[model samples]
Target: MSTRGNPWAVYRRLLSYARPHLGVYLLGVLGMMLYAATEAGLAGLVKFFARGTFLKHDPTVLWLIPVAVVGLFLLRGLGDFTSNYFPGWVGRRVIKQLRQEVFSHYLRLPTSFLDGQQSGHLLSKLTYNTEMVSAAATNASVSLIRDSLSVIVLLVYLFYLNWRLAFFCIAAAPPIGWLMQVANRSFRRYSTRIQNSMGDITRVAKEAIDAHRLIKIFNAEEHQSERFERVNEANRASNMKLVFASALSNPVVQLITSFALAGVLYVSERQVFAHRLPIDVFFGFFAAAMMVPPHLRRLVNISGPLQQGIAAGESVFEILDQAPENRGGGLPIERARGEIEFRNVCFDYAGGKGPVLQDLSFRVQAGETVAIVGRSGSGKTTLASLLPRFYDVSGGAVLLDGHDVREYRLEDLRAQVSLVSQEVVLFNDTIRNNIAFNAAGKTDAEILEAARAANVIEFVAQQPLGLASPLADRGQNLSGGQRQRISIARALLKDSPVLILDEATAALDNESERRVQQELALLMRGRTTLVIAHRLSTVENADRIIVLDRGRIVETGTHQQLLAADGLYAALHGMQFNA
Candidate 1:
């Protein structure tokens, strides 16, 4: 859905975050009430001052006025503290809770959802949009409540001083309210557009940063700059629309209030001069009427942030409402024997972009090693992905240990498999932690043993920090071989019954590949392994190799048998050797 959701509903839902801290929120409301009363009381004091000095002629009135002024301001300061501190406290809490929930939900969302979203846009919602929500929930909300109450109290005081004049002063209310309604609609529309444009800006900037190497190599600086400028300009233009509305609203409301004030002053003067109104009452009504303008101005100004916040809330709630990844059935497995079968499987990505795999059937008995060889786009990776249920088959079923993979709990199913892909993902963390990632109850000795098996200890031991050394982001601090070995170490630590290696040695040089292959051989021992390889040499020792063309497996047999048959496998091996 678009971010321009119903403002009232968005705001109401946003307020619900404060429900857990209602006691503090109510205390803030009480503080605002106390502050509002003091403002009205200050207006009333004007009448008392006039009467005590000019009418009553009492000497003690001088001391009473100064003392009361001090007392009033002192109480007002306390009220201000309570109102600012408590609501701000609740607002910060709301921001934290909302941020946490959105981030956690992101982790559970389907792979399809993640693939369709730009990471930058998600980050913007987490950081920038959430800040906007807090501004509306706290600052705008508090100003709205406090200033509105102040306006009401001041109007009541004016009515008490002179009912007829007060009635004339509020005659412009309906028209001003109507004008504010128009401004609010404009505010919300522009605010939604501004937020979306901000996301675009973030998306472009992040892409440029992440792909800096590509842009530089391709001499595309000007291209990236142009793209950034487009989104940046759009963001600025959207903000200007909100600015124009907000700027115009305040002046118009002020003009309307001025007209009402002029009428009040004209009527009050004539009444007092004609001896129909008391002098003190006339002054008190004037003081109370004057207080309304500042409060009105605040109420007008707050609408911009309030509406922007509502728009932000709409964006945040959209993600929160999304269906999470399907976690499959109730059956759970601590471990599986890892006999895997793909039964007449067919698969397609979203939008029905034709089948990537069709009528593909294969099985690997427990503790067997099978290599899948194919040209690019031959569905090799897609077939392996099915084992972990990254994308379910469009038809047919995948089974693990004679049980449909769909009938096993997603977590339990994934726990039985380890994947090592060409792109090794390592967090910016210590080598030890990366190897032991979330593998609960693994002793340091076990961790070290896995590192040794994966050949990670050889390089790690040469460093002063050993396994404690921290890697840079995506393991940029290490060579491709080192990163690959660290990934293998992770898989070794997992020690699952099944493993899938998709060009795991593709990036390494020959020497490093040889070293890593030795470790991979150890990792594959006695485990059901599916290896997707482009290099024929890498899979020559497999018990069997399946040759795929397009989405179909054209041949399956031992390497020598496939070569003797002179089919697709022989053609692939010939091409690799010729290259």
Candidate 2:
């Protein structure tokens, strides 16, 4: 369903998430029925009091009335407890299921979709927006259900006493409903703005937290504070607008209800004075009429949360409704032979931009180490990304082992490849777990072996916990060389037949780079490795090198062959070495 569709539609979808806990929800409904029963019971007691105290003048009446009042209140308290408890129980479960589904959807969404969305905004929907939905689903729902029943039952009691007075109050409902409808529209608009402002606040705060070192080094604390202030003020202003609307709505509704009550008083007084109505029946009717206004006020107040929830739920449903990445065909392979080819491949980010790679053709023979050297933005990284199908080519096909890669199951295809990039991503976990991440079947003996090969054992032996030592976030506890080595160990543990090393040694010191290069050479053995690098020296030992410029191969040969030609490669090499 379109998120922009009717809000009632979005509301129904939110209710459906609560369907699995229907048995618990029904218990809450029974509580509401009990609460509604008290409304009629109170009106009946008033009539009995008027008769017993005024006309019967019985000596037994005083004690009996107080006991009946106490009994009625005790039952009401029990009703209140069940009504709040059971629905609250169901509300929490709904939130859990919603968060789980949304987070799972986040994991499966396409990379392209994620690229277009803000992480902070999405996070707000997961946390802030979901909480707003809970208030609407549970608290507001309780008021709507119990109070609506109260109003209906009280109105019925009023009609039983005297139909004319009940009819006059019913006439006032249309205008109150009109005012509520106006308030609902204002509430929805402000609620959507509040959610967006909250996203902006989260975004700014996250950016500052992630870049604390940068901000401190640049002395930009004041700048960041100003940025945060803008979003924070925006959120405050939006909330105030909702407050204004809510404040205005309640009194105006009461004012209209007051007018209805006054008119009923004027009409009923004449009937009582003319002896057309008894004082007891008039007292009972007035008591029931007084009860209806509070229910109407509560009903009006509930519109704000109800609309806020609808807006929040619509945003959440938008994420849940998105199309996940295609899982690809069913063709299965335990291990690929690692023959990769690009057949006149062309690609755009497909985000209203020109193609990044245009009609590019390339091949890597089984177990061959081919290095791609390029200047920045020359599509070297884009070319490497296509092999793993992080993106499908817009105009051509990427093939593996004489079959289109799209014909293979996505998981099975990715299983044959391993990646180690300059920006190493390590979770805050044990050193052993970082290397063994997603390497489901590897034995502990093999993990130690991969660690040793990648030079991670050099540092692990120095630590007290050895492989069990925990790393800081993004492995900040480790040096550049140490972090790169752990990533290499992770890639090495995977043992995939195809490997893409994207400037893996680019960020390290010269001594560290040299040491990592030794590990790289060891890891490259028996695997079809595609090495992307800017430094010409690293690719010199490769069996073949492809020099890329503007998304096309400008030179392809052995390193000496390109140097002898005195072209882009020779010039690039001369600039690095001769300078």
Candidate 3:
């Protein structure tokens, strides 16, 4: 359920993403082995030089020494290059694959999950957190394997030179390893804190950026800055804690190595002075002993990134493991007749926070336009939302054409409905693309027809590029009325049998609203329409008007009938007319 208990399990799961490129990873490992071998070979060469030149005093060895040094370094450079480049290549590929999966998963997540989550934190996980996973997948792994092998190889050579002194040198290993375990726990704790702090930083900054206009109008620059500073400081503090542990770990491990080196040297000097150890043996053993420190330092430094990566991997996997939106229905339909019925339906949000919608029953005949009017929090939007199964009813059922909505395949159920909400959303693309979004294969002529019907052609005719004109983010470049028209055009293109207009024309001015209303009237023909409007004037012409009070249907009748009754409908109509 949580990735806290076993970091290796998380890391192994992350590595599975890289399994497709196994050949590349194996090549990198081979390079690391070669690098370690070369390091050990250099220590052996040191013994050869000491024996040939100092002991035997051979002339041929003099020429051989320089040639051997150049050849050995050349192989070392080759090994280093392979080890660095191939793993780096694999790391970048893994990042791309992981980010794609996470992003795609977000798109299919249950609406309730999206409703409760902050977009900024989700973006941070996709961008920053996935980047950290790369360190664990490739860099930390390479350092771990390469440095560990180097240490092992050096110890083996040292043992060959003098087994007794070699055994003494590694006596510091147990304590150093214990220190690493302590540092590892600290590193993981601080890394998780740092990642969470980064998400907070992203959330605060995104809010400030998106509300820049509000901030300026209210002169809240200092207020926003102070909020940002707090998150920024928290992020910095978390990172520094990790840095402190990583910096401390290296020196402490090195100090332990230094003690071992001193003891080994002290014992070796007496052995050589008493003719118990050969000069060549002393030089080879000392060379290998010196080699241990750098390898030890690398092993110690790697724990920081490895733990950070594991933390990142855990966060990424958590999202991937979330249950996707339920798509479980065997029944399929090409299209619904647009008849809708809510039978004693009840609903609540994820946490079982008291019911947002109480027992309610209603029916809308096919090809009928029904208007639902209620004050804010009367569950009008929630009621419309259920038709397309955004959130399932907690009790009872929502049926379409005599069958439970859940019985229809999720895609088929959604395809039968089209929604235009108060909050219009448009991408940074051409007006034509926005209208035809997810409905590819629409010819230019078909797109033009939808745009014309929505009155979008009136505005596009004035732009230099017409329908091809690009919009700024969320269509910021367009006026409110223009953006609304684009959304209406999208719904028009969908041409679903069941249409939901949730304050669709709320953004339009009087003149634009009249024009768009004519287009909506044309689009609503032959479709079962559910209109949710705060402005009673907009719904006066519905075939039937249903007045809701706190999620219950209080009254229902035609406009004239409802007015004559002098109830909630009449009161709402009176308030709007007076305003």
Q: Candidate 1: deviation at residue 354, Å?
A: 1.4
Tens-digit lDDT string for candidate 1 (5-32): 5677777788888899999999999999
For model 3, how does the per-residue alpha-carbon lDDT over 1-579 read when each residue is reduced to its tens digit? 555558978877888889999899889989998999999889989988999989999998889989999999999998898898899899999999999999999989999988988888898999899999998878898999999989998888888879989988889899889998998888888988988998999999999998988999999999999999999999999999988888888889888988898889889888988999999988888887888888888888888889999998888888888889999488998978989999999988888558888898989999999999989889899999998999999999999999999999999999999998878989888888999999986888889999999889999999999999988777887887888888889988988999999998887788878877887888888999999998888899999999988888899999999999999999988898888
**C-alpha lDDT score of every prediction, in listed order:** 0.90, 0.90, 0.90
The TM-score leader among the candidates is: 3
Better of 2 and 3 by TM-score: 3
Tell me the tens digit of each residue's lDDT in model 2 across 179-228.
98998898999999999999999989988998989999999999999999
State the TM-score for model 3. Answer: 0.98
In model 3, the worst 10-residue window by lDDT is 1-10
Error of model 3, residue 575, in angstroms: 1.1
| Every model's TM-score | 0.97, 0.97, 0.98
List where candidate 3 sits over 4 angstroms from the true fold. Answer: 1-4
Listing every candidate in turn, what is its Cα RMSD in Å to the true structure after a full C-alpha superposition?
A: 1.7, 1.4, 1.3
List where candidate 1 sits over 4 angstroms from the true fold.
1-4
Ranking by lDDT: 2, 1, 3
